[model samples]
Target: MVDVGDDAPTFSAPMTTPSGDIEEFSLADATDDGPVVLAFFPGAFTSVCASEMTTFRDRLDDLTDAGASLYGVSVDSPFALEEFATQNNLNFPLVSDIAKEVIDAYDVSMDFDALGVEGVAKRAVFVVDADGTVTYEWVSDDPGIEPDYEDVEAAVGDA
Candidate 1:
């Protein structure tokens, strides 16, 4: 897994835009603007995932105020992500890692044998500074778990 102080692995992938359009999102481009928060969830529309996303939506202003941009990453397609964003009223972008490359690169990939789900992202959060260094990292094996929003905000503020 990517650790704090390590250079963040940059990636470009399909993402849901604020206008509900599918577009390419580049980590390099986003970090060029400011620090970034990458929150990886297992799947969209699931109870825990929805709650986590809504929480981030409600607290987005705090991160932006700290000069940070937030993105919710998942293995879902851009189309599904767009719908999920619209349903949740999410203001931030939702990145599509349908290829599972991002999850593998971050070492957060997991399998749910019982559910027949494979190569899905484990719940994880990585705070990357403008310089592309990971400033903070939190990962959970339990899909029901959520990151500490305040801690993420603090990390972004520090970044």
Candidate 2:
């Protein structure tokens, strides 16, 4: 997993925003002057994923006030992400990692053999500084559990 102090791997990928517009998003571009929070969930429209994203959406101000932007990532397609964003009323970008490259680079891929789903991203969060360094990272084996928002906020604030 990419840890704190490590250089963040930058990528340009397609994302669906709250307005249902599909656009290309780049990590380096997002961190021009502040920190960014990348929230990787297993799949779109799942219960835990929905709840986590909704919490992030509801606390958008806290993140913005901390000089940070949040992006929700999953292996879902752009169409699904658009629908998900619309359904959740998310004001941030719901990124499409359909290629699984981002999740692999961050080492958050999961194996769900029993459910027959593989290469799904684990529940994870990454805070990256403007200089492209990873300031904080959290990965969970259990997808149902959400990351500590307070810790994430503090990390972004410190970054």
Candidate 3:
């Protein structure tokens, strides 16, 4: 597995937005020559992810002040994400991962119920530096746990 301190894998890929619109975005887009905090979740409309993302949204200003841009990723359809964002009022880009390509590349997928659940992304966080190096990555099973914002802020500021 690629862990913290490992170089980040930067790529430009297609991810639908909350409007069910297909768009290609680069991790570079969010970085803005600074740091980026990429949060990956299994799907949308879940309590855990909702809470996590809402928290991120609420504190986006602080994250930006720390020179970090926040992004959320999930395997839900763009249509689903649109409804989810409408319901939850998420401001940041809620990226679609219907194909699971990026999720698999990040090594955060799992298999279950004889399904392609392995293709769905697992909950995780990755902080990349200005040069696209992964400075920190946290992959965990407990989706209920909120991310360590203090750590994220420090990393972004120091990066």
- Candidate 1: regions farther than 4 A off: none
Model 1 lDDT per residue over 61-84, tens place: 999999999999999999999999
| lDDT on C-alpha atoms for all candidate structures | 0.96, 0.93, 0.76
Model 2 earns a TM-score of 0.98
* TM of each candidate vs. truth: 0.99, 0.98, 0.85
Model 2, residue 151: distance off in Å is 0.6
| Tens digits of per-residue lDDT for model 2, 26-70 | 999999968999999999888999999999998889999988999
> On residues 1-159, what C-alpha lDDT tens digit does candidate 3 reach at each position?
667777776666556564556677688765665888888987788788888888887878887887777778888876677788778877777777777777877888865546545566677888898878888888876656767867777777777
Q: After superposition, how far is residue 132 of candidate 3 from its true place, in Å?
A: 0.4
User: In what order do the candidates fall by TM-score, top score first?
Assistant: 1, 2, 3
TM-score-better candidate, 1 vs 3: 1
Best by TM-score: 1
